[model samples]
Target: MSILITGATGLLGRAIYAQCQAQFPTLDIIGTGFSRAQAPLVQLDLNDAAAVRAFFAKYQPSVVIHAAAERKPDVCENDPEQTLALNVETSRLLAELCHEQQSRLFFISTDYVFDGKNAPYAENATPNPLNFYGKSKMMAEQAIVAINPSHTIIRVPVLYGEVEYLAESAVTVIAQQIQQNPQSSHDHWAVRYPTHVADVAQTIADLIALPAAQSAGIFHVSDSQAMTKYDMACVIAAALGQNASSLVAVPEPTQSAARPYNCALKDTRLKQLGIVHSRKFDVAIQQIITRS
Candidate 1:
């Protein structure tokens, strides 16, 4: 049984692929992406529907783990049509293709589906996205469900680690400040779920191994804690053996792309499935720092 992983070169996707390879070495993993160093890339562009169909028809993968998307909120807001086309339209096309191929699709979603006014969103909560990016993702989620009932949409929140997206979003940002001025205390206040990318990826791999009846639905993947941007910086600082109190809270962005303050999601359903991980925020931080 071969599994097709899109965005295999991405931070989360690569992490998931690595963990899956470790756990299920015998499973055929067809890693696909445009990047050469993305490790087993298929050179498949999502926008090209015919190409996507051709690739799926050729592979006929039984399990599809789709972790690709235009994730940046500001980028999405800057180009709504492009964002919708990439995030929504591409997913719609993939869902249809996966249905025809008889593949079990597991699409990555975000906690941003909720406006953040409500913290610890549940699996069944009504999505009230406050921004265009969230709207597009929620649209994709709904569309994926409509296209294939066998699909599993996993919603993860503000992910970080020693790897790809973390460097861009959290690790590098904190390390830069620490390197520049070990005493600088600014740029904080954005709160998030702060999930470990490796953990989220492993959770996906675990869910896919479960029986179809058990893993098919919406699942919120995140840490057990809710933290502000400052909190995250503190974690990073502590992990790097720096001073946490050296960082200070700054005013958050009022209106730019879109971010949910309380997008922290509860993993109750995943917990019920005995799918637990290192919920200790410090453990995840330490892991990232060690590898960083």
Candidate 2:
């Protein structure tokens, strides 16, 4: 079987591509990035409809994992048109192509779709996005479902993992800040279940192995443990053998785009599939630090 992965140069996409190659050695895998001319990733801009159509025609992949998006909430809020073009329009195009090719499209979504009012959101939770980024993703999900009900949608929380670049993951960004200035402060209000990208990749592989009867619809791939940014910073500091005592806890600051206060997702469906093996927050953080 052939698989096509978009945003292959990104954190989660890269991890998914690597894990798929390692686990399914005989499978044909094609990765695409916007401008990256890397060996494994071809330069294909999803915004270009003609180019994307040509790519799908050439590859005719059995599975298409749509992982590219304008993820920054503030940036999306600032440029709603661009956000819609990149997040929603690209996804719609890919969904149409995948449907024509009879390929399973795995769209990577985010937990930000939930309104922070609820604690742990389930797969069936109603999405009330507070920011344009989340709204775009929700629209994409709806479009994909309308086009192809058998497609898979995986919603993940804040992700941190082994990155090609040091500052790619938010966890590593925090580590860099702590290293620069041990006396740093972080938001104590916003809560998130920071999941490892490797775990997300493994979940994708497992889903692929499952029968079509089992692997359709939305699945949450989040860590069970939820913590505040302050808590995450402390964990990073501790893992790096730095003094977290110097870190101060501050209230969540206002942003151009409002973020969910507690967008922790519950992986009930994934657990039901018997494929949920999320690593502990501390353990994952330590591993990332050690690897860095």
Candidate 3:
């Protein structure tokens, strides 16, 4: 049976596809995308219910990885209605289709589902989203659970990798900045869990490879350790063999969307599933550096 992945053109989706291809070489993988990429893609828009339903019917995916979302907090803030329409409503449609097909749905969620007042939120913690993006994601989570009780909701932290667009990734952006301005000091202040897309992808692929009974319900996927944005910058710098001091601390910039200071997640469930994430910040940074 094929594993169908939505948002295959995006970073997370692409990473998941890559990991699946590497780990499960003989498994069939179908990728859907809004914009075309190197992978085989079915160009179907999630917002268009007809297109999505048709894709679902034709593909008949046994495993559906829902990685598509309007995740930019600022963009979602600017257009809350669009965010809801794309993230929540579209998700409901997909969940319904998955249920009809009896496919296991792995829904990608966010740490932003929390209010950020508490660090390292648990899987069972009540989600009180502090921003529009968070609200939309939370809505999707609820809708998916309502539609398909067999779904797996995987909540992830902010991701960074080498192959990214718009300089949106913290790790990539910091690495580039350090390369350009090796002597500048603005890298040590911003810190996050900084989960590598590869690790996140690996975890998801591993889950999908498991039996249905082994893969169900919500799972928090994050690093074992939580680091600030500043700490991430220092790691990036050190990986490049540059002076970590060159990455200086800067005041927190104003954000259009509310940020949860405590967006970190604890992955006790993932650990129990034998998927312990022990990638240190330095090792993750080096991976990015090597790949970059």
Candidate 4:
């Protein structure tokens, strides 16, 4: 079956597009992007209603993985309008279009949906987002289910893998900061599960392989290893053969936007399907660092 992947130029979307091609070589794979669109990747603005509809009509993809979004908490906080338009409005439009075309939509959501008070969140847990980014995704989730109950919502935690630049991902940005300034400080108050993008892409592919009825609704995909920004920085320091002691660990909230301490997503639904893929943070980060 043919597949459409939005935000193809993005970190996660790029990985998803490549992974899908590797897994399903014979199937049609169309990628959409804005700034970085190339020959194979179409330049389609998801915010434009007419363009999105026209493109969907032309491709008639059986499945659409909507991975495009404004994920930064601070950015979303700074410009709520843009965040709402890109994250929430875009999903609303895609949901409507996918339903009209009878194509299943797999929306990429964030673990930021929950407050830090809760430890491990189940699929059925109610979202109490601590940031605008998370709230937008939560609203988009509601819109998607309302527009098309058969659609899927895949919520993932902090992601890092195969970046075009270190700044592209929060996980890799730690390395970038340390490289630039060995005395850089990192937040130690928050705990995060940094899942590899490839694993999440593989999880999506496995879900797409299942029947629509079986894979519909919410699913959490994340690595089990927990680490704060300080923890990640230390790991990066070790990989660089630098002393981890040089990095300062700030124990209070530092960002402009409010952040949840820990949002550990429980993949009970995925466990039931017997589909899982994960890797150790230290080992994977080393490979990524070496590659860069």
Candidate 5:
């Protein structure tokens, strides 16, 4: 079987692709990236409809993991047009093509779909996005489900893991701040579930290996650890042998893009499937920081 992975060079995509390679060694795993595509990953612009169609026809990947999207809330807020095109339109196109090709699609979504007023959102929970990034992802989720209800959709919260750079991940950036300035102030208002990318990757691989009867529909894959930027900084500070008390905590929402106070995703579906892959943030993050 051939599997296709989009955004293969990204923080989460890289982990997903790696997991697929390790778990399904015999299957053909084709990866795609835009600006950073290298050998084993073809440079394909998802927006080019003709090109995307041609590539799909050539590869005919039996399973398609649609992970490419504009994930930054502030960036999406600033350029709604680009966000819609990349996050919504491209996803819609992928769903259509996957249906035509008889390929099962696994669309990546976000916990940001909820307004943050609600905690531990269910797989079928109603979406009330507070920002463009979340709205675009919610739109993509709807379009994918409309085209094919059997297709799987996985929604995760903020992710961190092995990264090419420290600043590449929202969680790892805390370490950067701690390294740069001991007195840096971090947001203590918003609560987040900073999941490890490797865990999310393993969950996807497990889902793909499931029987056809149990593989379809939406699934939430997230860590249970609830933390804020300040909390993360404290952990990161401990890892770096720095003083956690040196950092300042701002007890209010920060950042240009609106963030949810606590969009904790309830992974009841995955749990029911006996698919569990989680690590303590304090433990896993220390390894991540050490590697970086």
Candidate 6:
């Protein structure tokens, strides 16, 4: 069986690709990104339906993990058209193709789908996104479900792990800032579960390995531990052996798009499926630092 991964150059996509290769060595894997043309990965703009269709026809994958999106909330808010094209339209096209081809689809969603009014959202919670990015993802999720209910939807929160790009993740960005200036401070308002990307990848692999009848629902994969950006920054600083005392904790600043203050998710579904294996924030941070 062949599996195709979109946004392969991204932090989560890269980790998933690596883990799929490592754990399922005999599985055929194809990865696509915007401009990167590395081995096992080709450049394919998901926005172009013709390109996507051609690639799908060529590969004829039995599974497609859709991970490409306009992830930045501000960018999505400012450019709603681009966001719709990438996040919604592309997803619709992929869903239709997957349905036609009888391919199982795995969509990586975010905890931002839920409003911050409720903390530790469950897998079955209704989504009320606060920003265009989140709304776009919610729309995609709905479209995927409507098009093919058998698809797997995995929602994750604030992922951080080893990456080819050091500044790709918020955790690494905070670490870089602290390395540059120890007195750097960050927002303490929004609480998030900084899940490790490796954990998310493993969860996807495990889901793929499961029987089809048992793996076709929404699942939340996140660390049980939640922390604010400030707490995360302090942990990252401490991991780097830098004194975190000087790191300031300030209120969240205003932005173009509204951010959910409590977007932490509870992986009850994953736990029930015996697939929840998230690392603590501090331990994950240390692993990232060590790898770096």
> Where's the lowest-lDDT run of ten residues in candidate 2?
163-172
Better of 2 and 3 by lDDT: 2
Question: How high a TM-score does candidate 2 get?
Answer: 0.96
Please list all clashing residue pairs in model 4, or write none if there are none.
none
Clashing residue pairs in candidate 6 (N, C-alpha, C atoms within 3 angstroms): none
> Model 4, 16-123: lDDT tens per residue?
999999988999999999989997999999889899889989999999999999999999999999999999999999999889888999999999999978889999
Top lDDT hit: 4
**Of candidates 4 and 2, the better by lDDT:** 4
Candidate 2: which stretches are off by over 4 Å? none
lDDT of 2 by residue, 1-292 (tens): 8989999899999999998899889999899898764886899988899999998998899988888888889989999999999999999999999888788889999998988898688899999998898999999999999998889999998888987656887667888888888998887888888889999999998998788658899999988777888899999999989889999898875667898899888889887778876778888778877888
Residue-by-residue lDDT tens digits, candidate 1, 1-292: 8888888877777788788788889988888777444435677888888898888888888888888888888888999999998899989988998888777899999888899887768899999998888999999999999987769999988777656433465444666676577676654555676777788878988998898888988998887676776676777678888877767777675557767667778888999989987567787667766765
Every model's TM-score: 0.91, 0.96, 0.90, 0.99, 0.99, 0.96
Off by over 4 Å in 1: 36-39, 164-166, 181-188
Model 5 residue 87 lDDT score? 96
Model 3 residue 120 CA deviation (Å) reads: 2.5
Candidate 3's displacement at residue 139, Å, is 0.7
Worst 10 residues of 3 by lDDT: 183-192
Writing each residue's lDDT as its tens digit, candidate 3 over 180-201 gives: 8876545232235777788889
Off by over 4 Å in 5: none
Clashing pairs in 5: none
Q: What is the C-alpha RMSD of each candidate to the true structure, in Å?
A: 2.1, 1.3, 2.4, 0.7, 0.8, 1.3
Candidate 1 lands at a TM-score of: 0.91
Deviation from native of the Cα of residue 219 in model 1, angstroms: 0.6
